[model samples]
Structures are given as C-alpha cells and as structure tokens.
Target: MSASARVIRSAEFQAERAWGALPVAELDGVTVRLHWTDSPYIWHVNDGEEVFVVLDGQVCMKVREQGVEQVHWLQPGDIFHAREGCEHVAHPQGVARVLVVEREGSV
Candidate 1:
C-alpha cells in the first residue's frame, strides 16, 4: 500500500443512518472505511494490531478467541484498540463511519 492517506483518520462524511458497511480498502495495515450504516465485520487474527476509530457513526463489536468472546458498544468519536491474535465481530448501532488501522504484529 502507498503512504499517502486519502481519508484522514478523524474525518466524517454524509450524515445518514446506514444499516451496513461497504469496505473501501487497506492502507498501511489499516482498513479504509466507506460505509453508511453499521454492520458486523469479522476479524480473524494471527498476530495483528488494529485501530478502529469512528469518524462518523458508532460501532458494536464482538471479539472471540478459543473459548472467549465479548461484545462492545462504540459511539461516534470512539476508538477501539485491538491487539494481535484477536478474533472479533463488529457491528455499529447507527449510521457509522470508522477508520480501521491494522498492523502485522501483536500489540
């Protein structure tokens, strides 16, 4: 991936209540979000650190590994930090826009 950033980390766009998220692409280990609504996105990890920051809407997330899984409620202006090897499912409750940055290593 290139080093130039297209969408800034904290930028929001088009205020609307969306029900699902459409993926944009990956940038420097982070996933560029371009969705209108909130949907559950899964992360199957094998040592990768990720940063999930809401630029417009909130995100509901669930992480599962081995025999453990947990849920979360994320609002706009909220950031979720994830370490490596964490499997998760994320779904926001409203029209949510988020910037997901992940690195190939354990945090």
Candidate 2:
C-alpha cells in the first residue's frame, strides 16, 4: 500500500462472483468494505450500526421492523442505514457492488 493519502476507485475494487467482501480501510471502531453480490444474504442483525451504500447495480433490502418485514429497492447512489439490532438481508438483482461501513467484526 502507498504511504501517501489517496482516493479509492469504488468501481474498480476487487470482486469476483456471488458475494465477496474486500476490506478497504479501517477507522476507529469502524471498517469500510466493498462488497459484490449476485444473491441474497441470510437474515442477520448487526452487532452495531451499519451504513450500506449502493455503488452499482440494484439491491432489494429486506428489513424487519416491529414484527413486519419491509422491502426497500436500492439503486446506485442509494444509501441504507441499519441500526444495531435491525434484522435485515440484502438481495442483489444481479451483479452489484456496495460499500459498507460498520463496526469492526460486526455481522
């Protein structure tokens, strides 16, 4: 890695097929990761807050709230924030890239 400050080319980040997560950087109690997915992830709750940003393609975010399930369709540039204890899952329509910011080691 270069020692100088730089920019991250979100579109060019490393990703193969299905779902993949590549760590970009880590901040105090936070981790930034680039994710690529073509399928839905299992329902889960984060240990802490999560900021999910769609960089490319589309995603359907399934969130459970007050005993009800809500679906949110996300496009490029859309951002979805999930607070801790918010059960949710992400379903990518096809090949999609997302930037996620959350507590380190959270799931």
Candidate 3:
C-alpha cells in the first residue's frame, strides 16, 4: 500500500475523553498516535518499547524501578522513552496533548 504525508496541528487536537488517542500512522508494526488527556493513565509495561512526547501542557510521568517509584515532570517538547517491561504511567497536570509511538497491539 502507498502512503501520503500530511500536516497535523497538535495544538488544535482534542478528544472526547481523557486518555483518548487519535490514530496517526503505522510504520511496519509500530503505531503512532496522538493522545489527549486531563487525567492519569494506568500503570502498564509495554511489551515493546515506547516513545512518548509531550506536545502541549504538562505531564508527570511515574516510573517504577526495582521497588521504588520515581516522578518525572514533562513539559512541551519533552520526550520520554520506555523500554520493554518498563513500568510507567502518565498524569496530565490539566489538559495535555502527547505523541506516542509503540508496537501495535502492545499494552
């Protein structure tokens, strides 16, 4: 199949609910998505690597290592990378827009 490139205005993006994601593109077996949220996401470990980018607003990323949980503050333009089996979650300060790339069907 052929693919066409287009522009996406992330600042103008919105979703019906918190943590809602808009499908962006698929490369090989990886999926790119735009997520809008005002709430926190559940802790999960991706089966594959994940790239998370904050496009708007702020987010607090919580990561669990060993038995300790750490907090990371993310602002616009900040990027977070989670390797496979890494436990983490994201909590939006208010409203936020994020770009995420991960293996398709991963949790």
Candidate 4:
C-alpha cells in the first residue's frame, strides 16, 4: 500500500460551505472522515462499529435504547463509540467538526 503524509487543519475545515464530510483515509475497508455540521443528522443504525471523535465545538449525541431515548453531551476531545445495530443521532450545538471512523459504505 502506498501512503503519504499530510496535514489537516480541522478547525478550518469545511465542505462546500455546507454541512457535509471530507474523506480522509481508508484502511482495510474502514474509512476515516472529517465532518462539519451545524445541524442534526438522521437517526440510523450502523451496519458496523463506529468511532466518533469530537474535534472542535460541541455536540449532543442521542441514542435509542430499548425504545427509550438518551442524550449525552460531547465536547472537544470527547469520543463516542457505537456498536453495530446501535441506533443513534448527533446534533451539533453549532458549527462542529468531527472525526469519524467506520466500515466503508456503512450508514
């Protein structure tokens, strides 16, 4: 596999001036992405495990467990891990940047 070094200023990252993502890297069918958003994402369950890291700003993570919804506050440097089949959604307090790692094509 070929690899090169690069630098990403996460704080200054944006995609089309909208809430979206930028592909970072991939390894063994897993994908790493940098996402910027000021809105909430749809609630869905991942087909595989997911690792979400708050890179900048704040977010409120919501998970549905046993039909009960739970909410957790996330700040910069906080990490949230979602196992396969875990239903969850993320709501950004403002414009927030996040690093997400998961199986490619998973949603």
Candidate 5:
C-alpha cells in the first residue's frame, strides 16, 4: 500500500494564475485537482461523476436538468456533485479556489 500527503496553499496557487488547474493526486480511478478560476467554464458533460468543492470564494454552478438550466450558488466549503452525463458549467464569482475529484481524464 502507498499513501501520500501534501500541504497546499490555496491562496498562493490562486494568485499564480487567473484560471488554471494543478494536479494534486491520483489513486485508483480518481484524480484530484486544485483549480483557480475567475471566469466561467464552457458547458460540458463528464464521462463520469465529478465532485466539485469550493475551498475559497464563491461559484455559480449552471446545470442542464430536464431540458432546463439551473443555477446553484456555492460558497466556501460547499460541494456540488455532477453525475455522469450531467451537462454543467462553472462560473466563479471572483477568485475561487476549487478542489475537483473525478475520474482521470473524464473532462
């Protein structure tokens, strides 16, 4: 068995880029990434489920459900789960640090 640990400074990471993702870990079939964004991402569907966690700032998660678009506001510590085939896009309110967990290369 192998285990690893890391200390991430979210603020530092966010300050480095306006919008970007940093790979943190990969185990089994899941990959963990740290994202810093101040813009909206294009709508897309994940090949598998995705766990989006807000570590800092806010996010407006837009999802297409039942042929309608729904907006979910997320704050720090909030989480939004997107099941497979769920079309969604993320809009950051400002400088937001997000932790994303999903199947490797699902996006």
Candidate 6:
C-alpha cells in the first residue's frame, strides 16, 4: 500500500534474492519485498536509510565501519535498518526472508 493511499506496484522494482541483490517492491514513499541471501554485504548502507524486515533466516546486520551496531539471527517479522550514509553488511548463515524499505531518495 501507499504511504497515504493504496498499494501500487512499482514496475521499476522486481527482484528475487537468494544469493544476490534483490530488486525491490513498488514504492512511492518506501519499498518492500522478500529477500534471502548469504553474504558479508547484505546490509551495506550508502547515503540512505534501509529498513529490513526479517521473515526467516540467520542474518547479521552490522556497520562495516564502526563495528558497533549489530543485528543478528533475525526471524519472522523482525525489522532493522541501515544507518544513513553508513555502510552495512548482512551475513546470513541460513536462508531467510526479508522485507527491505528504502525511501525514494539516496539508497
């Protein structure tokens, strides 16, 4: 759904992440979708805010710079975000589902 209206599918966004970068769901204010991957670069943020909703999986979201903020082993409905202008990476130990939201800006 829209941020203030109804849901509108974004044709510019379409991706499936198993072991790669997931595209994104339709978005006007924010984006949403499911994703799963094994990586050391899952939550890398750059000049934008990225929110991740974990559906199922073993994942770690951490700043690749500070190394202080860390989110790991998320499950269904778990949500997290990448700091703006901060780089993040997700290390998934097992397969999982994730809904990522990146607003219509630097992402």
Which residue runs of candidate 1 sit more than 4 Å off their true CA positions?
1-37, 104-107
lDDT of 4 at 59: 93
Give per-model CA RMSD.
6.0, 1.8, 2.3, 2.4, 2.8, 5.9
By lDDT: ranked, best first: 3, 4, 2, 5, 1, 6
Q: Which stretches of candidate 2 lie over 4 Å from their true place?
A: none
**Model 2: per-residue lDDT, tens digit, 27-95?**
998999899887888999999999999999999999998889999999999999999899999999988
The TM-scores of all predictions, comma-separated, are: 0.59, 0.89, 0.94, 0.93, 0.89, 0.60
Q: Which pairs, if any, clash in model 4?
A: none
lDDT of 3 by residue, 18-42 (tens): 9888999999999999999999999
**Model 6: runs farther than 4 Å from truth?**
1-24, 39-43, 65-71, 104-107
TM-score of 3: 0.94
lDDT of 1 by residue, 1-107 (tens): 46754544434454345433345665565555545554555566636677877767667788886778788888777888777667776777755677665543322
Q: State the local distance difference test value for candidate 6.
A: 0.59
Whole-model Cα lDDT of every candidate shown, in order:
0.62, 0.90, 0.94, 0.92, 0.90, 0.59
Could you tell me the TM-score of candidate 5? Answer: 0.89
Give the candidate number with the greatest lDDT. 3
Per-residue lDDT for 7 in model 3? 81
Model 6 per-residue lDDT tens digits across residues 2-106: 576654233232336454335545667665555556444445455678887765665666665666765455666677766677777766765655667776554
What's the TM for model 1?
A: 0.59
Model 3: CA > 4 A from native: 1-3
Evaluated at residue 5, the lDDT of candidate 5 is 56
